[model samples]
Target: MVEDGHFWTETNWVFIEVETDEGVVGVGEANWTVFRARTVVQALEDMERFAVGLNPFDVETLRQRMYNGNHFLHTPGVVQSMVIGAIEMACWDIMGKVTGQPVYNLLGGKVNDRIRSYTYMHYKWMPPEPPEKAAEAARHYVDKGFTAVKLDPVRPKEGPRNPRIDELEYAEAAVAAVREEVGNEADILIGTHGQLYTHSARRLAARLEPYDPLWFEEPVPPENFGELREVVDSTSIPVSTGERLLTVHQMAQAVENGVRIIQPNVGLTGLLEARKMAGIAQAHYAQVAPWMYAGPIAGAASVHLCAAIPNYLLQESLEGWNGFHNDILEDGLEWDNGDLIPPEKPGLGVEFDRSVLESYAGEYRPESS
Candidate 1:
């Protein structure tokens, strides 16, 4: 039940419990933005006809049937994919429990020692103040042994822009200071937040090229592929994007449009389709750098995806302090230097402390409520 009113921005989840005749109950979660929660739940109810009595171990068949049965929903993107995704993850979890192996082991074993990670700066509350201060904070992350970082150099401090060059200087100064502190050694990611016009995006990408960032992300937004193509064409620096994007078709478009780095969110992209998207990226010779914006479960799920794929470049991470991340998970993923031991349990391989979620689940403010 939704303890709050409706799932919007709150930390709400739609968990699926698959009960068997033998009394085995497998659980999985499809956590999305408040708006999409109902979509996923509806998809689950509609798709249950093929799932209820089927052998959960026949995961491939079940997945194919779900895709094929609901071809219309599955084709466009994660709306239906998430419904199947929750089942897919739960099936894997059950299989792992039955076979006594880790989920990564089931997905063709691990490829790397650990999933390398990067933390994001300028994420809402932590807006860009100044370059020197941003640099100092980045150094603090490095001191904590993180090897990579991501920053959004541009933000509308007051409100929406009116085609003005308003925070432009602040943006440049912030990126410059970050570069100064990291000193070209750290793997820095400069995100434009897709806020610039086409020409402005090109100019901003050129300006940050000297810093040698890991990749310039979402420079021109996702709506206009032509704009994205223009920015990519003008810059020698690599471009990373696609958090707002979900399907293979969109990623195929991004790759065909010449994006060098692909950043799909596993929570939104679904687990198996994300792998498929990576394969498409491989055909274009683009590296995959999946984005992370959720709590530990999503992080663990993303890491599992990264482990199986050959083209994974890096995964996004946040350098945890006390209060910011402490309430999010039961136990933090083990981060050694800059890598997390991909949850080896079953399915997503981790669970959140429900009590913590309950504590953080605040009031609902929807009109119906």
Candidate 2:
């Protein structure tokens, strides 16, 4: 603990590298934060049983077989998604190695010529002096050439501290001030992080409507699809959610319920699983606004998924976190305007920076069993 001072709360990045008979290696990551760590790790180990000898080039067949296998672990949740994500991504990586093409080409082709990127800023880090402080930070990001920003305007809590209406009023003023500083050209995405109640979400969404946010994300918690729809129906602002949601089935329910954009975390469900989720969303005429909350490996994976999906919306990018992503991966992405261009290299377009991984070894240590 003393070496890095204190424990980093969310720095866990677990990438599984599968070695093939031809001496080729494929890499994938599993984000265990969404499920029981022990269960998720054991699931990955179990997946290895079926994956050890299979041809990694055939990604979809491998995924379907695993999905159809009548295992207790196949029930909808993070563990299954993590297992599928890890295996499918490794398979895609192997295919990229065997074919000498980037993962993007394997999943059809790029939708947009470029991937739009946004930074996730900590609202509390915005000085906390006043609403103007958040505005100042917003201007700084805009000046740095960023086209969009994401922040959780709601208090990071389970329930309301005061009258729900009062909190909404407060959040409105703060977001309004921020919008004023950043101007209309900058896109603002407000996140509720699945923390607010239905009434609270509606009020908050109504308040943010004037700011013309790109999306009012996860207004209510995602547990009930009906409530998610209720929040969506009640607000004029477009609703976006599904980062906590793991499978295609859950994504279908959200889309059917009228969610305008789907946000799938590549780390939580792996890359291909997220793509499938996006595909399902696309079929419903909904856009896919992918969720990426980790370092560069997840970020890179998200970029590939976003590129391949036809219904891709703006992507979440972690721009200002210098040297944090360098811990696990060797390469980084470039952001121009709002787009994130994943480097065109073989098999996921990057390699594990072993020295960087070692430097952040304690942070990378597996919490999953």
Candidate 3:
């Protein structure tokens, strides 16, 4: 696990390494939250008994054993989902390597040769005052060949509460500035981080509708689908959500409530379950845009999942997959223009540099025997 210094939260990236007796190894990443890396590690350790000595090829069986075996502890949430996802992901990786095919090939086959991606405008560049900074940041990525950029314009430190009118105005001005600068050259995605109440989100969406964003993401907290549907019915702009959703059942709830675009995080859902989620969305004529706020391993898993699913929308990118991401992965994810070229190599098509991963690795202390 490595400390994430990019955001304000005290988050750490937790990676899973599942090795086999034959020497093949697979990698996966768990979704990270403030001070939860060690907790996830503990969960993974607790799960080792169910995972070890299992056939890596039997992903579904393994998933069931890990998920159902826990009984009451198996309720869908961040920790359990993250733990199951990390192991399931590594199992797929091992399967791909054993078969000499990419994980996408194992899932089915690639429908997309290259996957389109969008990156967030850094929080520092998206100040509420002087909305021009938002435009400038949007332009920087647009110039770099990105066709879409996401921003959380109204990030009030405290909420589930409603934003004041002045705050709403700042958000409107920011989106308006971005639209003015980018014109029709690129799409704008508004990320609200579920900071607002239902009515507040609807109000904010009304103000932003004129700017024509590609999607309004998680305007309200994810707990209530009724409220989420309320925002969906209230907006002309497409409402996207599911980053916080842990299971396919929850995704189904969102889709049934009129969510057309679902954003499942492979880091939490795992590739097989995410593919299943995409399938569920596909039946409803909805699109799947895998979320990618975790580490590169999860990002790679998302890429493979997106490649195979026919209802693929687009995947989230972290600043074109540069900086520490490049340093840790063997060759890093291949980016040309704005699209990620699907890897032809076996497994997830990415490998971590041991030295770099070790440099960032935190000491894990197992419970007393």
Candidate 4:
């Protein structure tokens, strides 16, 4: 059944453990926010047929083979990308361990020492806050030193099939309140659940422009390239998208179609393709802001990718879950003044406490339950 749309994360994940003959094991996660975790795991297991015995150092060959060997799983959605991405991440981990260098160093070293972090004000499954409370929340985040925050002032899609006049009023009030509260101390990111049609999106964009948001994210849904371009053309506010998009080709299309910021999830596109995409976007003068709402393994991988890319922008981090997320990893990441300092340790700089796999086994259960 359809429900409220927010950026709340679903925990169910497919984990990859790549073991070397030398007894070194690298960890990776393939997160599924919209699909079944077990199915992704099954897909990953199936992919082992192509992965086995391949030179772990030559990850590009295996990465290409994993994406190509399965004809039925090509480019439809996150399923194929997540499966291949998990293995690719593990490969990087292995490569880092073998080379005695951090993953970012292997990627030609860091362009940044610390990457800026951006987060949502209210996420999925949380009750919606009124305009005043929304403003207060924005203030609190700023007080905590977060220079950027994202929010969707629009009502839940499950509530209305179309935009209501009153809903427009509410949306305006929310942005107005946040803008007033934060003033110039922070950047307000207006996020749509991709619920708005072309005109409704334009209306909201025009109303919010006076407040000066960092960008308007996915005002229209991902599948509608034409509508996405329409929204981009309608606003001077730089438009951003591509979390639902998979692979270098899809992201390339989004950039060519006028998306100023490309948000690639490290768990989906993996580091290799995302690195390639970042290079591509940099040459075209666009930015790559790695989007992650998954485990710390994926987050660490994104941090490495962002560190290595010159055109890197903000990274998405789940606000409330940091404590528990960090607990699951041996050397977890932390936020300092809204920036996460990348680790210089070998590989992607994250090592999992294997016990977390058993402790959080519930996330691996079937979706039907």
Top model number, lDDT: 3
Q: Model 1: which ten-residue window has the lowest total lDDT?
A: 1-10
- The digit string of per-residue lDDT tens for model 4 on 1-369 reads 012322335566567898877777777889754556667876777777877777778888887787776686554467778877888898899899988989999887988997888878874212256789888878877887788988888966742135778888888888898899999989999888688888888988888889899889888888878878998999889999978888888888888889989899889888888998887788789998888878778888999998898999899877733666776778777678889888888988887776975786555445565
* lDDT string, candidate 1, 1-369, tens digits: 112221122445666667666765565666564666656666788788878788878877887788777556556455666677677767766676677776677767788767877776543224446567788778877777778887777764321222246556666677788778888557788876677778877777776777777888887768778778998899898877888786777888988898979998776766666888888999988999988665455566678888888888988875542243445557656777777777666555555567876676544344544
lDDT of each: 0.71, 0.73, 0.86, 0.80
Off by over 4 Å in 3: 1-10, 365-369
Off by over 4 Å in 1: 1-11, 23-25, 35-43, 68-78, 123-128, 156-163, 321-332, 352-368
RMSD of each: 4.7, 3.5, 2.7, 3.6
lDDT of 1: 0.71
lDDT of 4: 0.80
Q: 118, model 1: CA deviation in Å?
A: 0.7
Please give the lDDT score at residue 184 for candidate 2.
73
List the candidates ranked by lDDT, beginning with the highest: 3, 4, 2, 1
Clashing pairs in 4: none
lDDT of 1 at 187: 79
Off by over 4 Å in 4: 1-8, 33-35, 74-76, 123-128, 158-161, 363-369
Q: How does residue 188 of candidate 1 score in lDDT?
A: 80
Best by TM-score: 3
TM-score of 2: 0.89
List runs of model 2 lying over 4 Å from the truth.
Answer: 1-9, 32-39, 123-129, 159-163, 363-369
Q: Give the Cα RMSD of candidate 2.
A: 3.5
Supply every candidate's count of residue pairs whose N, Cα or C atoms clash at under 3 angstroms.
3, 2, 0, 0
Regarding lDDT, does 2 or 3 come out ahead? Answer: 3
